[model samples]
Target: MTFFLLRFIFACLLLPCLWTTASAEAVSFPELGSAVPGHGDVTYLDLARMVIPDLAADKDGFFRGSIPIEMRHIAGPDYDGSPPATSGLSSGDVLNIKAGGKDRLAMLLDLGDSPDSAEGYAVLALYDITGKPALLDAVNVAVDRSTYFRDPGKLSIGPGDDVIITTSTHFNSSQGYVIAPLVMVRNDRFELIDMIYTFDENLCTNRRTQNVAFQAIADSQLYAAIKVTVTDATVPGDESCDGQPPPEASSRDISVTYHWDKNASRYVKDSDALDRLADDNAKRF
Candidate 1:
């Protein structure tokens, strides 16, 4: 009897220790303040100012409805920016404008990179410009998915009214990206919704089963949404991305959706638009 009691006590003690160890390995929300590998010029200000998009809100639904990102650093600057930088389409850089494209505000936002998968920081900005027609209302983008190897930050921001961002990695899955999504949302008033990651993937192509995934958002009440996606676009057997990505314009594509439902009092995906979302919520440099 004493032996069994002692064994029980020992097992209890070991369990807690194991729990702590496992918990430590898990990643959480917004990897803000994380370094960008190099670029000493990038002060913490750069990191703090940076906004990475969570796959949950980017890869799919973004193109389904509502606002769309026109252009940014992704175009190398000339395509956007106040001064014009590079070829006008690098990969990940962002800007925002009013609804109709009247007010133009540009932020030199940064995108983080990762060696393991598509990586970078992303920041989204939006505005109301019912005056201009050749303009836009919001700008969303990703950054730094270069030939890297570390688990660089893969998150974005929805800074409220004119902004939105990534939830936490807790919303992500073990496949290297978020599966369900614990995204932070706001309008005039910003607040992190306290819901567990409970969504599903609707898009992903040319990758492993359950390994690659995508997400989308739609508003049944307002008729709007943002989408997100993830895929091992890197060359086959070359996970480091040190090699060229298969092709953004690939004929094959995969995607999913996430959206809000007035009747359900939550997000729902009555539709899907994977390819369009990839082009919209693009990664930044």
Candidate 2:
């Protein structure tokens, strides 16, 4: 079937990332039913595999920090009551899934409270995973109610122990969609960081297309997190850089994409990965 083949190819592509390691105990998010709670459906590889390097320099590549995330996946199910993964917007709702070690802290991105509807905005919530999860901090970072859906998002690590992400918005009024960079960083206090030109849409007409991915900043000394966005613009804005969209490509309709640039030179996209993920979703059943 198409779905099987797609997963096969995707896994093949990621083969370089896999290694034989001692497998950790597998725990499921029973209530939410995804690898990560509230993230909707996605493949749950072993918790051991889900672990990223620690934020501190002195520690080994594992996050010895309080947060131990058991589940994390860049590609998987779309979490809309579907078994196989599906692409595109499921709801305008922002969810804070249980993450961190032992699900100790539930960091969520709440993107729904718009005048029109919660249609893809941000209302980040950090919760304490008690016997019952307790909402510790609930803050609204950004909102795009006009014609955008902010459902699917990716996570990364920013400088200074910050969490960075890149998410896309599907517009209701425009012809092109938007790709943006957002972050949860601390300044004396924890605050969300929104990059300037994250939108892929024009002030007017962008319809389809989505943006995602947010790789941690490998070199904390040089810059912020590295992002791999999907864009139709062969150069830019067909897929514009965050905050500084190209004038000509600002309002065009296009398909999905995935691209990577080693240097964070204006949000380059890897149309291949995005295209592959979308392609895989279609055949996932």
Best by lDDT: 2
TM-score of each: 0.25, 0.35
lDDT of 1 at 229: 39
Compute the lDDT of residue 161 as modeled in candidate 1: 21
Model 1: ten consecutive residues of lowest lDDT: 146-155
lDDT of all predictions, in order shown? 0.28, 0.31
Badly placed stretches (over 4 Å) of model 1 are: 1-94, 97-186, 190-220, 225-254, 263-266, 269-285
Question: Which lDDT value does model 1 have at 230?
Answer: 37
Root mean square deviation (Cα) for candidate 1: 21.7
What digit string (tens of lDDT, one per residue) describes model 1 on residues 1-285?
342253234334223212122232122222223322233344222322222222122343221112123434321333232311211111222233221113332232322222232433233433222232111223323322211101111222221222222221211231322212223323322222211122122223223222222222333334345443333232223232444443333222344545555686544543445434434333310
lDDT score, candidate 2, position 84: 13
Worst 10 residues of 2 by lDDT: 79-88
* Tens-digit lDDT track of model 2 for 1-285: 443353234334323322122122211122211244443333121221122112221233221222222221112123111111111111122233323222333233222333433333343344443344344443333433222112223343332233434333333333333334354433222333433232222332222233333344454332343544333332233443555654543432233222223464323333345445445334521
> Which candidate's TM-score is highest?
2
